[model samples]
Target: MFYDSYLYLVDGSYLPTVAPTGLKTDLGCWKYHFGAIEGMRQNGWTLWTVILIRLVAEEFNFKLSIMGQGDNQMLLIEFTETLPEEVTVNQVNQFISALEEKLSYIGPPLKIEETWISKDYLLYGKFPIKNRVALTTSWKKNCRMFRCCNEDFPTIETSLSSLAANLYAAVASDNVTQPIFFLSISDGHNQQFSLFLVIYQ
Candidate 1:
């Protein structure tokens, strides 16, 4: 027989014959690694990226984190959070655009990316320019520069770090805290909204 076949006794009778084909069992070792998480943790940082973006969503926060990156290409991001049901992917993108507009003072346009994370959305941003040293502090009274199109961005009242970490902790820890600065865009009075951000360096 050209093909292998099994023979078995049925009703006290021999069934069939078989060919000489055979199979081997040993399989070579497979090695897989995720250097991203390992490196981030070692560098005293972590990426809080979202894992999923669902169709019908409600009550959540969503953003990506690039932490302790030594260079531009090698970045580790972890997205984590949920959003209210009324918000859609398109609306989130619009909000991201607004943030880009607000941070225009930093220079270079922002390149945005949305990834899926645990039935939620993971928002990521890439600055067109690189090698910019970033410092995060609470809104210091001296460096506060916040305002809507109607009013100039007020000078920050806390260090950028303090403000940033507080926001991250609030969302990461699920504790709500009023943001120190809000941007209303084109108008400062009625359009204001608080936000938490993860800056890439």
Candidate 2:
């Protein structure tokens, strides 16, 4: 059995070609990849989801958006970063306001559904979201907040680069007796890089 998978990145970017099994005939094989495939039963492809993974820090901000119409819809935004030394009420207000404005632009009626802030190390105190009553109320109504420890999530670029490099390395090794190859492409002017790996048994 073979399968073709599509991984959509944070910036709504994706690689066009099939992955893993590299079969492009139909979506039937994908049932084994994503268990309980929703798009399969509907007779229409409706499973369009994007993963938002980022490392946030002081003066660091990122935005992501995905708009579509479907029965199974979900949008989640997460930021993992070290705790800053000091954060002002004004700063928090500004961040929330900007997030609200950005969410308004999404085509689907998608609510945040949840918002979480977790701390690690010697910080075990109440991180208040009550500074702005209106914003807090809106958040409370639309989002669920939670507290926990920080986790490390890979950025899309790092993940892609690592995957391409590893695949190339495996094919280039002496142990592989198969006639397989790969190409590392880079456009120096545009600062774009891509690795194409083709395998034949």
TM-score of 1: 0.19
Best by lDDT: 2
**lDDT tens per residue, model 1, 137-201:** 33332132333122244222333334444444334322222343342122123223222222221
Per-residue lDDT tens digits of candidate 2, residues 37-88? 4455442333322221111122334332233335432222233355353443
Per-model TM against the reference: 0.19, 0.20
Poorly placed runs, candidate 2 (over 4 Å): 1-84, 88-93, 121-201
